[model samples]
Target chain A: MLSIQVIADVWDRHLITMRTIEHLHMFSIALILSIIIGVSVGVFIYMKPKTANPVLNFLNIVETIPDLALIVLLLPILKLGAGPTIAACVLYSILPIARNTYTGLKSVDEQYTYVAQAIGLSPREALMKVRIPMSLPLIAGGIRIALVFCMGVVTLGGLVAAGGLGTVLQNGIQLYQKDAILVAGLWTGLLAVLLDGFAGMIEKKLHERYGTW
Target chain B: MQTERLFDRIESIQFKGITKKYGEGFAVKELDLEIIGGELLILIGPSGSGKTTTLRMINRMIEQDEGSVTINGIDTKDADPVRLRRNIGYVIQNIGLFPHMTIRENIGLVPKIEKQNKKDIEERVKTLLDFVSLPPEMFMNRYPKQLSGGQQQRVGLARAMAMDPPLFLMDEPFGALDPILRKQLQKEFLKIKNEINRTIVFVTHDIEEALVLGDRIAIMDQGELVQVGPPEELIFNPANELVADIVDNQRKFKHMDTLKVKDLMSPFEDKYVLEAKMEACDAVDEMTDRDLETAFVFEGDELLGQVEIVDLMKCRDRGEKLSELAKPIKTFQPMDSVAFALSEMKNSGEYLAIVMNSKHPVGILVSDEVLLKLI
Candidate 1:
């Protein structure tokens, strides 16, 4: 008969691998969607600031909902798994990226815009050619922060038996399998750390290119 | 675009009771003026004097609270801002080349947006680059970041000229350069303007630049145009103390025209025949045939001083040989301005200053000639 510890070790190894992959999977989708939706919404608000306040206030209200309850409520409709998990992750990611985008684009120097116009560029031409290039670094930084935070939420998604690292953690909890829980926790931490480091390097490179904070 | 052919005849611009207010007070108040075409007009004043505000009103960049600006007999209030702006070229201190675009792309931008063919746009860009002396092969593909400030300003100039607009409004385009470079560029631009004659409305606070470039200058104070006139007229007779102070500094540059050697040359000086030591005996008679009153003797190519006929006659009486005189001829340096030469002439109390190249006297100018030309 296999020792319980031996079974626990096998569960621990499987949980580690699954959790790492799940964290990457959930965060990646959320981050990519946030970039597209966030940049668009940010640019829209930047173009018309008068209408942006109410929309930002609405997003602020949505952010007030508790993360776990929000996930559970989404579970019934999305039927648990990667879908509901991704939706929750994406919802959490937009606030920072969208806000950053709006602020960054809006803050491009007016003199730069005036120069572009005096040189005969239309408004859209000036924004795309001058303002956006200058503002991208700040927007990218916000996305980096959003991605790291979303990874943490994704591991929590594993609790719904979504086959993420949270599955091993939950199963280990049930049987008092200390090793299994430890491995699952270790992998989740490593995953968040590696992703964050990657994003940080990219953000730094972008900031250097655009000379922005 | 040549000045005479600009719309067959010059069109006069009229601003009718133009008023622009930020809040309670007016930024530009009930101002009325007329601007004639083919003239280089400079608008100058202190900060917040509405000089820029007035220029912007010409193209309607800022909406006037109450008033109408008419250009070429058309009411600017009813015209489309974009269309009006396109017809007029505008340049600012920043030289705003699009950061992401190549020089060619920035210069070619308006034509591209207007749906011109690729070939035509490329041709226009190349032509403009050449006209600005920034060759296309060297600068066309380079980004703005790669260019120096002066080069970028030239690119800005090229971009403004791309549309072949009849009117150009420049808001301190060279205001950001260091003074020396700014002066050099201003002088260089005069040569360029001689070739391309478009109606130019320039804005600047520097009085020297205004005096150098302006055919007519309009001085503004608190958004009001206090006076406008030709540079010479403005300097001699200012509208008030403000105008007088602005012109007082420009008087220095005017001295450049008065300091020529030809202006100081005299007609009545004893003529000296300039001759080489190797000149044959027949050449001595040749000098006398030319009605020489004196002879300037030389050794090989070196200048020896004046040998008067009286001195030679006295030498003949004493049974002595003819020789070169040891006196130095007063001379004016070629590069010295007429004013400096005149001052030097006055200081020395000399009737003439010899115009020279190094130690050689090229010509001579009298005090009376220099004084006549000073006016």
Candidate 2:
């Protein structure tokens, strides 16, 4: 029987802690950049609905490419490391955020926009004040999905020596260390659950504030 | 009224040889019409007959492909579309109160956009809420989703009037409501318009609504202005077959002008008067003795209001004076038609209409008497 001490020892390792921090840093940076790019693209497409299908299709195609293949494809330009791994994760994250944003914006009641125009709000003002605020719950939902998704894919960072829980699992498997593998996998799962729960809380709060729920 | 002077500035909207086309066909073709300021001019037609197109062109929502639409001789094209729209009130059938905004915020939007002071905006919102008959305290904090359809449309109207714009464009504003609510709103709107005196271009396909509400009815067919005139003129002297056909459907409203309030109302008498300081018990006793349901409560010759026998009986203090128990009277000039008086009586839920000559109450038109005349 594996002792609790064994699991505690692995959890206390400085190297694992460092890897966890690095994993969070990469995930957060990529997620932030993805959100900015994704939401911007979404707003652009919403303004001109004719471009929606083409743009979403292009992103859909990117999503279809395997995660490792996309990382490797970026390797030629960004080279192997945290850079290419984060870039690939960001690319993967964009599809959900962009798609959800586009759908949410499109779903906003057009009557409000018509009133916005009739009342003389410039189109830009209407989008910012009315459309975006009204679509917040759906937009936040998209962001939450993207965040959880990025957390899972970020584990793959260890494959390129980018340093995350994946590296611990990889070393454990290579050396046939059962306790090490179990601890690493368990922590990664816990981290994902924690981040997803946090995102869910945020989404709930946004919906409540906007009274959209 | 403050709104009376607001109408004097902009006399009318003139459309001169205006035309708008979509693809191959004209949406509105060579429309030449004049809408008098301070009156509700209803542009009514069948669906796709260009009533909406004409209304939109006034606000520059849909730019005219040719000719000009002028408000008080200043062409709409000369003004910035956004600025011009800000100065015009608009209401649509959907009653688009922003779901995200509270009723207070929705009603105060245009004033906020105009950069009015916060105190002024708040005051204006309260005033508009009262004007629309929605109590501020109960409705101001509630969101749009919290309101019923009729309540939402009332908020929509209050929002439109936030800036007190001289020109209003209502595109089937009450078309989506149920019949009962629609009639109630129509009456409320007529009352509001009478006080505000703003020029209004209202579009509707409902012939009854057009005939009942419009100061002048403009009938359109196939993007052409078939005729424009007062409801009575259009009924008595329709320009063509189409006009006659439309008016023929609403023949009852046509006979309204034949009898004036003077002909219908009974002359004022000392028996109908009650001193303001008279005790509630005494007032009730007097009404009971005369078998009267209502009597005008007066502070010597000046009409304070009217007191109902039911209201006087309900007074907690038998010693309370009639002045304390009386409700404000709804007065109309003797020149007003019996149709107008009956409608007013129906709307106010009052059985008596105080017919005034100048400011003094000359007569009282009992609801039963008017009904008898109509029968």
Candidate 3:
């Protein structure tokens, strides 16, 4: 059985509460920025469908690059802080959201657009009113997937001196403290799961409201 | 918000020398037609027959490659396509009511877009729901998925009518319903069409539907209109084999319910008439000359009665008048069903009946003679 005193000792020594807040703070910024950019890029590709393949291919290549290397690459310009960390988090999270948004927008039933046009909706109006609303369920799903990616990158942020749960994790590994690493890693994973659960609930709600299938 | 009046009542829709090409084949070729206002004209044919293509050209859903479409003497080319569509109501096979919208919202969409007042829109939606036989209180907030297909179609019609357009274009609007539901919708639609009384161009492949609903039916084959006329004319005198085939199919579809007395009635010939003041001997001579057993005795416009040859002969020997031997005959109106007329003829023990229009005998309905006309 796990002792309560061992958990408390690890918590006080690593300042677990403060680290969790920092992790969430970086995670929130990255997720919000990723959502805005991803959705815009998705809309842009949808408008000019010819650009879809090339833009998605380019994003696909970025997604394959190792997340740690992506952060290391940004260190030259964004130099040793949360800036490189957050940039890396946004970079990694965009593909799922952008790809999902584009696919969702493009895949709306032809019947909808045809009816929208027949009923005298302007092309732009139809996109905003019919296409986007119908796309909400899929979009929410994409954002949920992006949330997981953001959490992973933000946890990696502490390796570059960006304060988060990762800082406690790095300290435990460097100092060879077994309890610190276990507690910090487990806490980070638990926080990501809780955030994923919250996003899942939102996704389910949107699916019920706007899902076509 | 002040709503602006864009299009006036449509007096005529003329498709003059219109042609539309798709790849190597023609979807519609040099079609010419005139649709009168307040009449429901049906365009019907087989799968590739250009009926839908022709209907779409009116609102520029698919613009023609050559010639022009004009409404009320104004060329449709001069109008903005979107504005023209907004002014014309449209319905399709699938009853494409927005799935995410409430019934009231779907019905009010176009009017709201036109900048109509909110409270007025709600009231109008309620009235429109009632117009389509849906209770507004029970259905206003329901999404389309919650309703049955028939109910959704009614909401589709209500949405189209929201703009109060002068013309409506329907492309197989009720094609998605089951037979019973389709028949129900057709009856409801005819009632609604009667109430709204707007110009409509409808497209369908069902011949029975065309015959039942159209004031004038236009049949197309391989991108050209084979015939355009009232249903009776098309059945009696088809322009080509395709049209004859369609008419033949219509007979099969309706199971002869569409056949009426007007289709088989003939003009009441003067040779079969005996003047009311004529001598019985002259009446016998006239009836013998025509090789007939009976002649109608008429004094100008008044139908006195039918004079049988045997009765006329008896009167002739006594030197009596043809009017004195006249006997009453059964009469029927031209619009009655052929089956009803046949049953009447059987009940009255008469093979022939006078086809009348209220006070005047317009034609003659003969059982064997009309059956021979079908050949």
Candidate 4:
């Protein structure tokens, strides 16, 4: 067995490298896909609100389930590991973004819409130029929330043999290795804080650009 | 300011039996009206009277369930909506500027969308800024948030005009502002409308605004046209009692054009000018030298009556208070016709009004100032 010091020596070297890269890969994939799915779902809900209500309700139900249990439940169908873990995180991220988009798009002032129409802008043109542009700040805010939530969930997702800091954390916990656990948990926490802060800056920039409070 | 020639292309609007129905009741029904080219048409009505619905129908923003709206000569239905909108300018009360864009970008949007050259768009944006009284160099780079409400409105007007649309649809664009700002913007808008000569469909609830701005007024009730005519005709001869009440409230303000100092100027009588504490003694001496008989005792242009030699001696003898001694100066606005001046003189019991711009005097409205020269 490798001495604890040797594992410590490699901890910053091999383990951190693998954890950070894999963490980034899984986080990015989950975030991008979730955004795509969430926005599409949001747009659909916007266009067909009656249809959206039921669909959104179902997603809200899915979000209510505990993340670890949801992953374990997914393991039965997808057979464990990164696939199920990433899938569960993506599911968790959907509610905030999708709901946000729907609400934002719906809440744009009716007068602006009428004015756009009076200017002879077509339905599509009004939606793209007036409605969508006006809703961007709120939509972006929702996306930021969803992204931070996903980042946190994905770090925890490493519990399921996913190749991220969660893997290091799980091993360190099982093996009673204090240094190993400290490094993974601490880095994951730091990355979450960093990502959250970055998303916040982007949100502020968007609000300033769009003249939204 | 390019004054669109008085006879430019005769861009009239005609609505033939237009009707809009929502479920059981009609919003507008069988509405027939002809809007002349280069005329501002103000549409006034209580809320839910379908005035807005009618405004929207012209641009097909709200589809009329029946009849046709023709611009120039082309039926609105046949015109492609996008292309149609490109040829029409729209302004709303809230001044809905695109939040994400700078003023320049907002004004140049339709041009940019049509793939106009960048240089042309820039030039047009700059020219439009100057036309709207906003300096391009300062406002062009600023976003809507940086602008005040009135500034945003002017930008909105510039954007609407950028495409040089022959028709303008304004839905109470100044209604949200405070009364002072609304009046100022209304005056500015009149100047702009004169410059552009765009056929306008202006909607408002305030009768004073309607009479002040409209060449022809269309009053609507429950989606029906109650009356349509020049403001004078509407006021003098209303189609019904409802129309009469609206015109009644606006009558006093409308009489502004009828009141003039020339109609009521009493005269520059009294051998000597007023000698008041406010007036420098040397200034009084100068008036005496000029063969001006009566010095009108004025407390800052409130023409205190003629300071006759008798009143001056009374001041010297009894020491009359300046406020009591100063005569009331009758005033007349440039727009006020002679009739109003005579009435104001009679009612105020003062031959002259302190003609003022706001609170400060501009000129004396003596009785002789009447164009008739009766004074």
Candidate 5:
């Protein structure tokens, strides 16, 4: 019978604690970087609305490229390390964040913008004060989606010799260590659920604070 | 009273041959108009008739392709558009109070943008809420979505009046409201306007609203001003078939021509009389003695229109003499149509009309008595 003791034994031997820390590190760095790049690009596209469809289409095409293929493609340029893995994860995260941000900003009531202008707010001021604040729930939603995407992609970083819980699962499978694989799989899922729940809490708080979606 | 002093500083807005075109079509053709300070000029027309376009030009929301729009003799183009807009208040039909901001913040926005003192902004916000008849304590903390349409519109108006700008531009400000609410807001707006004395350019497609609120009405058609005059002039002497047609709809239902002064006239009474040179207290005593509602002032053989006891009371309140309260007479022949007399009475805001027969006054036509006869 597969037991908890056996799972603990596998976790201790495989340095599961270090792998979990590496997984969280990769996910968080990629998420932060993705948010900065994605949000900025989204805002830029919103300002130059004519560019939105083209930019989003390009990002959509980038998203269609398999995650493994993207990691492989980046390997030659970035080499086998955390760098390429984080880059791949960031690339994977961009589509949801940028698309949601663009859609959110674009969908704000046109009357609010008109009133902002009529009240003499400069375009920049209006965007910052009215548009951005109103679009918060959606922007936060995008960030949450990107965080979830990062969690999954960070696990896949193991394929490129990048350190994370995926390495444990891969090694256990090769060695026929069922307990090791099960333990790693269980922790990875737990981490994903935990991070997702945290993101959900943030989105909820933002919706409550702004009182809007 | 403080608003009166602020009002006197505003100069008239002049549109000198201003023209705006969108591609091959003109939204507003070469237009020349002078909107007097502190007056409510209503621009009215059918859809796509350039009433909105003309109003937008005043604040340079839609730039004029030719000529210039000058506020207080200063060309709008010369002033920074943003700065110029900051100084002018604007309201729209949508009541665009920012949904994210509380009602207080929405109303205080202009003052905040203008960098007024924080305490002063709070005080002004409270004052404006009261002015619009919204209690600050009840509404200040609430978001716009929580308010009803009428309340949101009141907040919109309060927001526009936040900085107390001498000029206000409204583009169908109350067009979205139900008819009952529209009428109530219109009456309230008239009261507010009387107190503030701001130069207002109001846009509306409803002819009835135009007549009810405009100090002067400007009718537009095909991007051109068809006629501009007081509501009475527009009703009695329309510039063309279109203006006549607009008035005719209301005139037909009113049965205006069929009414005559003789049908509504009341017999002249001796008790309702006072000499032109009578003392103020004596006039009041005479009215009190007979329990008369009005007293006609006489100078020798000539008859002047009657002054209501209400006017005497108002004179007392203002510490003015009885002679100051003797309004000039509006005399109509007994054969004159009731519509004509009614129009005169509406224009003058007097309830009593003198019905004269060639040489002397024969009777009085009280609006209430006339209305009763109609029923």
Candidate 6:
């Protein structure tokens, strides 16, 4: 087993604590932007169903691009540091959130909408009152998925001088320090798992409230 | 905000040459129907016969291709569809109570949208629950899924009645119920209809339910109106073979099941009635003259059981009074179906049943009379 002092020494040498804060900061920004844009796109496609296929296909293509390749492509436009990393994370995350929202909105039992109309709910009211509430569990599920993707991408931010846990791992590889690589890698994974676990709890809460069906 | 027009009442709805088509086939074709205000008119037909389509047109759920649906002589096309719908109470087979909302929240949605006072809405919701015979205290806070199917349906009715719309459009609202529950709800619905003065357009495929609930029924076939009349007219003077067959085929076989003991009961003949103090010979003479196997013994309008002619003859030698020889008889409520009375008679080994209404004997049903009515 690795000694506690050795692990603490490695943690201090690369400033892993500051790197984690930077990783989380980038992750939050990217995730928030992804949620806003993804949900808007989902609602747009739902309202105009004809565009759903094209838009989702385009997002799928963005998702297929390797993470580093996406960052490299964005660097010319968004520059290095946290900007390209955040942009790449958002680009990767939008598909899952948008697709889930679209599916959720579409899958609401058709009867609820008919009832809404019969009860004199305008089209907007029907969407706001019935459709949105019914779709929440699914949207929350998508956000959970997006959360995992953001955590992974934000860790990779350090490779491009974005200052996250990924930078410590890069330093360990380049300098051939086994302690730095092992400790930073484990910590990054633990952070991602913790955040994902938090998101899962939120999803469970939303499911309880809105997935009574 | 523009003030939304409020329709205080709708007295009549007239469909003039209204048509709706899906692809090549017509859902409803050139249908003309006049619904008088405040009557429960049942639109009945086999499935796909356009009864539902016609009902939806009144509220503009399914818009007609041609012609106007005029409510109280105002063309529905001229009114905003949303504003028009708020004035119509609607119910469907699925009940359509929102799953996420509690019973109170579901019922109060429309009132909130219309900006009604909160206290008034709560009061109205309470009265509406009472109208459907559901006590608010127990059910008001429950969610839709928490209630049984029957309870959910009652909440559905409470929601529709919350609008207090002058016209109600119901499409097979009780079609999902089991037979026993359906009959009970039908009776309860009739009581509710009596309590409210409003027009109703009910759609159903079940002919028996239509006959039971309709003030007048309109039959549809292949997207065409076959006939429209009161249940008596359709049963007695059918305009065509299809109409005749509708009344004959469906109504006759299930007549015993649909008919109540009250419909077949006859008032006990005066000659066959005996006083409790009358001598056995006098009771025998009254029953014998009318050929009545049993005679009711009454002491000043109170039924004191019944005396059989055989028992009367046997007790004559002892000079026993009618009350002394009288045997207790089974009593059935008037609402009990004739079929129920027959099955009950078979089980109990008795053929005579006193039809009681509120503990007061109104009439008697004999096996022979029940058989005659069935035939």
TM-score of each: 0.71, 0.77, 0.78, 0.76, 0.75, 0.78
DockQ, Cα level, model 5: 0.32
Q: Report the interface RMSD that candidate 4 achieves against the true structure, in angstroms.
A: 2.3
Error of 2 at B128 (Å): 1.9
Error of 1 at B200 (Å): 1.4
Better of 4 and 5 by lDDT: 5
Please identify which of the two predictions, 1 or 2, would achieve the higher lDDT against the true structure: 2
DockQ order of candidates, best first?
6, 4, 3, 2, 5, 1
Which portions of model 2 miss their true places by more than 4 Å?
A1-4, A14-18, A79-81, A204-213, B1-8, B113-117, B253-375
Stretch of 10 with least lDDT, candidate 4 chain B: B366-375
By DockQ thresholds, what CAPRI class is model 3?
acceptable
lDDT of 4 by residue, A20-59 (tens): 8899899999988888888888888898878888988999
Number of colliding residue pairs in model 5? 0
lDDT per residue, candidate 5, B303-367, as tens digits?
Answer: 75557553464344345555566778788898898777876777777656777899777888765
Off by over 4 Å in 5: A1-4, A7-12, A201-213, B1-9, B113-119, B252-375
For model 4, the stretches where C-alpha displacement exceeds 4 angstroms are A1-10, A76-81, A211-213, B1-10, B250-375
- The all-Cα superposition gives candidate 1 an RMSD in Å to the true structure of 16.2
lDDT of 6 by residue, A61-158 (tens): 99999998999888889877999999998998899999999999999998899999987889888998899899999999999899998888887887
lDDT (tens digit, per residue) of candidate 3 on A1-213: 236888799999899899888888988999999999999999999999999999999999999999999999999999998999999888887888889999999889977988888878878878988899999988888899999988888888988989999999999999999888888888888888898999999998888888844
For residues B183-298, write the lDDT of model 4, one tens digit per residue.
55776788888888778999999886887789999999998999999887887789988998887663443454555544333333333344456433343334434433235565
**DockQ (CA atoms), all models:** 0.17, 0.37, 0.38, 0.39, 0.32, 0.47
lDDT by residue (B1-375, candidate 3, tens digit) is: 434545679889999999999999999999999999989999999899899889988888788999999998889999877788888899888748888789998899878887888999999999998888776876899888777676778888888888888999999998986553465478668879998899989998877678768999999988998889988798878887788888765353244456677776677767677888988877766665564556788888888878766456555457777667777777888788887777767667665678889987888776532222342
Q: What tens-digit string does per-residue lDDT give for candidate 2 at A164-200? A: 7878888888888888888898889999999999999
Model 6 ranges with Cα > 4 A deviation: A6-14, A174-176, B1-5, B115-120, B250-375
| Candidate 6 lDDT (Cα, 0 to 1) | 0.82
Error of 1 at B131 (Å): 3.0
**Model 5 chain B poorest ten-residue lDDT run:** B1-10
How much lDDT does each candidate structure score?
0.71, 0.81, 0.83, 0.74, 0.79, 0.82
